[model samples]
Target: MKNDSTPITKSRGPAEHEVRAQIVAAATEHFSHFGYEKTTVSDLARVIGYSKAYIYKFFESKQSIGEMICGNCLREIEAEVSAAIGQSDQPPEQLRRMFKACTEASLRLFFRDRKLYEIAASAATERWQTVIVYEANIQRLLREVLQAGRLSGDFERKTPLDETTMAIYLVMRPYLNPLLLQYSFDYTEDAPVQLSNLVLRSLSP
Candidate 1:
């Protein structure tokens, strides 16, 4: 005799992409408020209405979530940099605008979300490769501006492009580094203008 047992169907969960997005979103909120060291997988899972195991399914660890958040913040800054560069026809003006935009974006993000700044600082130390790649990309953008200025006679090209790029990066480090701004609170207000002036002057023909 055939038994009348019904087959049990497992419930379908959120799509992998959806799950990852949700995890990132919840993690962003947690990281923004509580910081990387304080925020845990359990905290994120609780905020997202998921189990820690569920969060783990999407993110390997809390650090992974912090990395994702830092990546998002960097992308936003990159976009701002691109937009600032696009707004000007003159290379020197473009460089100034880019500096202003990037500095402002960094300051805004740092002040608005200190926890996010903590994540960035941690990423710079722990996720060195990722931070290096981002720094390279920014330098590339600066190199483009420098090259354009050289062609337009807006900047003196006595130094090599790579050298000039590195110099600019060094000179602008205080303005660009969130941790530095956090410590040098007095400089925070005047950094964009002061740093941009210094950079533009260094680039001038």
Candidate 2:
């Protein structure tokens, strides 16, 4: 007689997560090669060797996958910047390092998954109003850094801290924007150096 009471083996949670990750990897490649407007869910599904319905089970749609991919990129930036910000005792140095990390991280991570970058860049162009809202939040975070520096007497500016922060962001905009970097003169060697020099000079008492 068999032991009918034995429990059935469940699907491993790690395996499920691995599947989800593979789906994202495949989607990123498809989007990068073809760009957002030209890619289709079927393409992603085919590359991953999964049915469209199964892919939908992991993600509701292609846009949903794009959001996840972009969110992963942002999280990486946040983590690196947060660490650099925390490590320095000097406010000006912290600000300088943060900007450097932001620029480098954006370049490295943005190009890592090319298809996703193309898709996101195209979508952002068409939906800039929404993109501005996201950008505003990032600007606000930078404002807080400026406020801290002002309180520390590390930065002296006639304008409000928020305004100064916005100006700093505007200055860095072209260097930080991936699309702009592709067209602009290469600053790979000097962008961070020039940025730090400008910040240091502007903030000196």
Candidate 3:
């Protein structure tokens, strides 16, 4: 008996995924190098040796590809933060590691495709919402990590955990500039060291 409502069972297939991954990898590289405005569908197709219509079969448009890339970056950052937290034995250390991991993840994503980020930033009209959602999700993940630290007595916070988390996010947001900027940079070698000190000092013992 054939069931018309049965969903296709292709989720575990490697070939389909590999093709899609290749497409995304090509698109990511193109977008990072050429940016959204400067990048075109033809460029992506040509790079991957696929026709324009073939690329369309996988991605509806360049914006769709950008959205997927942003999603991938967020997922990677989330995974890094999770792995750092999982590896730390001390709650306080976990808190410190979480911040450092977040910073590292941000730098990796920004540097992975510098031009793409610039394009996403510049095309406020196209990618503004996507970027906002990406950042907001990261903040939520960070807030959850902070809440865990507070629960473990690692964080001695007089202020609400949510408030403190928001403050931290605000402070670190500016640090992304050096990661994105190409010229002379004022490196914050002690950023993690300072963050650990600030958080421990602020928290109740």
Candidate 4:
């Protein structure tokens, strides 16, 4: 007599992408609330209903998660900058809108949660690759605007394209840097207009 037993298959959990998203989301919350340095893989795993090893399966390390969060932040800013740039045909106006969009986005994120801002700052300093890409993206946007301005005779080409791009980025540092904005005594209602006007004048033909 032959007795046969039914075969059992191991159950599959969430998809890899799903698990990664969940991990990133949970990590974002903890990092935003507790901070990057204080939050750990165990904390993320506990909140995510998984083991620390499971969390590691998705991210290589805590710094990787921080890089993901910072990358997401930069992606959002790029989207906003693209939208603002697309909405205007005039170079000066486009430049103004781009600057406003980027600064406002940064300020909104920084003001909404100081901890998140700190996390991003930390990631920017610790994750050199991410910072390099982020800076390159910003430079590309500035270069596009400056090129448009030069083509339209709105801005005089006083310096090389590369130099002008860096100069614009540096000039806008006060508005773009969250840490600097936090220390500004006059970052009130009139700050945007004042900064925009100053930048426009500097770029004027």
Candidate with best TM-score: 4
- Candidate with the larger TM-score of 1 and 4: 4
lDDT of 1 by residue, 60-161 (tens): 677777766776677677777877888887998888787788778877766687677788888766744445566666777888888888999989979988
Off by over 4 Å in 1: 1-15
Evaluate model 2: give its TM-score.
Answer: 0.75
Greater lDDT among 1 and 2 belongs to 1
RMSD of candidate 4 to the true fold? 11.8
Tens digit of per-residue lDDT, candidate 4, span 1-205: 0111111111134456767777788888888789878888888888888998877766777877777777777667677777888898888998888777877877776567777887766754564456567667777888888898899899988779898888778866666555566666366356666777888897877
Provide the lDDT at 2 for model 1.
Answer: 14
Give the clashing residue pairs of candidate 2, or none: 31-115, 32-114, 32-115
TM-scores of the models, in the order given: 0.84, 0.75, 0.71, 0.85
Candidates by lDDT, descending order: 1, 4, 2, 3
Clashing pairs in 1: none
Per-residue lDDT over 112-162 for candidate 3, one digit per residue giving the tens place of the 0 to 100 score: 666876654553345444556655665766676677777777776578767
Across residues 28-107, which tens digit of lDDT does each residue of candidate 2 receive? 77777888668788988888899988887777667667665665565566666667777787787777777787778777
TM-score-based ranking, best first?
4, 1, 2, 3
User: Candidate 2: where are CA atoms >4 Å away?
Assistant: 1-22, 32-35, 57-60, 112-114, 127-137
lDDT: the better of candidates 1 and 3: 1
What are the lDDT scores of the predictions, listed in order? 0.73, 0.67, 0.64, 0.72
C-alpha RMSD for every candidate: 11.7, 10.5, 7.7, 11.8
